[model samples]
Target chain A: MSVLVFSSLLFAASVAAGLLGAMTGLGGGVVIVPVLALLFKVDIRYAIGASLVSVIATSSGAAIAYVREGLSNIRVGMFLEVATTLGAVLGAYLAAKISGHWIAIIFGVVLLYSAISSFRSNVDHLVPIQPGTLASKLELTGRYTTADGTHAYSAERVPFGFGLMFGAGTLSGLLGIGSGAVKVLAMDQVMRLPFKVSTTTSNFMIGVTAAASAGIYLSRGYIDPTIALSVMLGVLCGSLLGTRVLVKARVSMLKQVFALVVVVLGIEMIYSGITGRI
Target chain B: MRRPSDHELELSVAGMLRFGVTAAAVVSIFGGLLYLRQPHASITRFQKFNAGGPGLRTISGIWHGMVHLDPRSMIQFGLVLLIATPVARVVFCVIGFARQKDRLYVLVSSIVLLVLLYSLGHGFQ
Candidate 1:
């Protein structure tokens, strides 16, 4: 295939990845990366670099709407970013050291994990709790609006959540994924934030974490400008369109289908990794 | 002197993010089109792993080439901008926090910004 054909095909795939990602809340990087590596025959490093760059674009773009809706907690997002950003830098540094096979396997494992988590998604029930002293000191408590009324929430385990954020950031940088599931796990399960608050706050931090990785990726020359441009633009456009359709569209079914697709992709990634085909 | 309210601060942060992503996307799309128009746009050589050329490596190099309307450099600049979006958000938050006399958050935000800036430093030289 020629560069034009490759770019056009990659862009189309990225659009579908982004759209499906937004609808299912799994994220574009997960789908796009495997497609790039497995199908497009792109090197794993460049595939991830492109995926990481697009992660920032879509996350940042979507975050605006989340912030404007007052669903995202800026205080929580900013505070936790300290850990995530540092982890991202560390992950990016490690990405350069690791071989392509290892990267592919790790990404595959993460994909499977995300698929399983999505299968059991939205199980968290919000229970009001007194935030830890550290959380209270940082004023990491707030309320979010629902159709009925506003519901108040607070962070429970500030330190644990911070640690988990570090892991999330590491996965993001390592695999060039948004790692939203991990972020949600930290915030919703461990930190005891409201579900809406957790998801939006994770969204809020995704870009920053990805940016940290993307910066390192770009400097390392992992980011190819042509591929990154196509992926970024496609994902951005697709996610934006996804958000619009999300309100009126039925997604529970879509989520299940997408999860199954992710499972197949996950297995493929691992197979490719083990066979040294990627 | 009045401080910006929380909602207002969030709005400012959102505005910064929106602007950064939009600007980055616009610049990237233009550059990508230019790139596609090149005669060699039909060649596909991504099958192997190469770190790429120095012309597209450093921040300064990308800027130097971008001035000459180098298509690849323009795309790199846009990617740089996209990477910088979250950094800009952190910076905006720092200002927002400082204005609110929220020293703790200002400190926290600054730390995040520092990490982002440090990562960016990798692209400098």
Candidate 2:
């Protein structure tokens, strides 16, 4: 296909991926990477490079609205960041030395895990406990009103949450997904935050985590501006539209459909990696 | 009932505008560049850069130069803009929050500001 035609298709695909990603909370990078690497036959490195930028865009675009809505737990996000940023730096260093194929395999596995987790779970509507700690004592924990009602949440197991963030950050740097699946898990499971608060807060933190690795990728020549720009633009536009639609859409069904898509994509990624076709 | 001070409202609005502009600018600039370039260029660049052989060194050199190209150095100038713009917004928000003594806003904006600085510093190398 001609370059013009190909780019147009990519643009459309990225927009669709972005919308689906934001609505489902799976993240745009997870979708973009497979589409670029496998379907479009782009190099995994460039695809990753592009995916990182989209991750940043997704976070930045989503964060502003989430924060304004008073849904994001800023204190929780900040406390966990110390661990995630550290891990991100380490992961970026490792990524520079690793082969693209291995990165693809890891990304594939993570996606599969995210798909399974999403499919198997239901959103927990638990009330939040008050935060305790020098950080929490500062009144970092708070309540947010979801569509259901006002749900209060809290941060617990501070140390464990931070540790998990470190691992999530590493994966984000390594594979460019912002590790939202893991971040949400850390907050919801380890910290015992309500799902709405955890998800929004996780979104708030993703931009910074992505920026950390994006910088490393940029310096190492992994990020190509042309590709990064395309992905970012598409994601930004799609996310805006998605956010609007999310308010009106039936979320459970959307999540189910998206989870199924992720599972299929994940299987394809793994197959490609093992076959050396990625 | 006490009304919100004009200065406070102005500050809040300014903070919101800063964020909106930054997000829009980044997306527009990057997206426009992508739209302008040929997909064939993207494909060719990807292949050439990834191809392993004696030409690998040459390809790396070219890719490195492209990344560091003048007027558009991805890491040097692009990164500076990316990091600086958001940080400036956070700082402005911090100042506004402090003026109002809104502890929550101050806390949140401060955390975001610090994270942005840390990400910029730790990211490039």
Candidate 3:
């Protein structure tokens, strides 16, 4: 296939990936990596490089809407970024040492984990509690709007949340995923922020975390503009369109279907990685 | 310094993000088309990782490439802009916090900014 034909195919696949990712809230980068590495036969490094660019595009694009809606907490997002950005830099440093095979295996495992977790619905009943000393000192408490009204919440377990963010950032840099699953886990589970706050705040931080590593990747010559350009454009277009469809469509059922697809893809990736087919 | 209200800050942040993504996408799409317009000697190898030439590996090289209207360099510049968007957000927040006399957050935002600058500086080395 010629370069033009190949780029067209990639653009189509990324559009689908972005749509499903936005509809299901799983993120386009997760779907992008497996499809590129498995179906398109792209090198893992290049696939990762391309997917990271899309992750930034979709994330920043969606985050604009989220911030404008007053869903994302800028203070919390900024505070937590110090941890995530550091972790991203460290993770990028490590990626150069690890071979592509290990990356594939790790990516497969992370996909399966994300698939299983997506099977469970998000817990919405956040028990309000006073934030810990560190959180209180940093003034991380904030309010978010819900259907009921403006709800106030405070962060807890600041160290734990920060630590989780480090891990999230590392995985993002290593696997070229947005690592939204881990970011949400840190904010929603460990930090004790409300679900809305956690989701939007995670979205707010994703671009910054990806950027930290993206700079490193660019310097290392992993990012190919030709591949990255198609991906960035495709995912941005898809996610924007997905947001429009979201209001009209019930996405619960779509999430389950997409979750199953994720599992199947994860298994294939693992199998391929073990067999050296990738 | 006159402190911007939270509402104003939020608007600025959103505006920055929106502009960054749109500008990057437009530039990337243009570069992509320019790239596709060129003939390929072989099917572009998707399976092998190609470390592109020095045109994008260093800041000086990217600047030179931009002057020459290189498609790859333009795409790289777009990507750089995308990365810088968040960094710009952090800078704005620092200014906002400092203006508000919120010393703690100004300190926190400063640390994030420093980390970003450090990584970028290292990237150039």
Give the top-scoring candidate (TM-score): 1
Q: Point out the worst 10-residue segment of candidate 3 chain B by lDDT.
A: B38-47
Q: lDDT (CA) for every model shown?
A: 0.86, 0.67, 0.84
lDDT of 2 by residue, A82-176 (tens): 67767877788888788776877788899888887675464674645644564366454676666778766556777787889999999988887
Provide the lowest-lDDT 10-residue window in model 3 chain A: A124-133
lDDT of 3 by residue, A211-230 (tens): 88887888888787778887
Alpha-carbon interface RMSD for all candidates, in angstroms:
1.3, 6.1, 1.5
Q: Per-residue alpha-carbon lDDT of model 3 for B1-125, expressed as tens digits? A: 57787668878877888888788777766766677677766644667877777788777787788778787788888887787888888888998898889999999999988888877775576
Cα RMSD to the true fold for all candidates = 1.5, 5.6, 1.7
TM-score list, all predictions: 0.96, 0.78, 0.96
Q: What value does the TM-score of chain B take for model 3?
A: 0.87
Q: Candidate 2 overall Cα lDDT vs. reference?
A: 0.67
Worst 10 residues of 1 chain A by lDDT: A123-132
Candidate 1 local lDDT, A1-278, one digit each (tens)? 77888889888999999999988888877888899989888888888899999888988888767877778888999988888988998899899898888888898899999988876646544556464577778888887778888777778878999999999999889989889989999998898888778889888888889988887888778899988888888998899899888899999999999999999999999899899998
Which stretches in model 1 have alpha-carbon errors above 4 Å? A121-132, B41-44
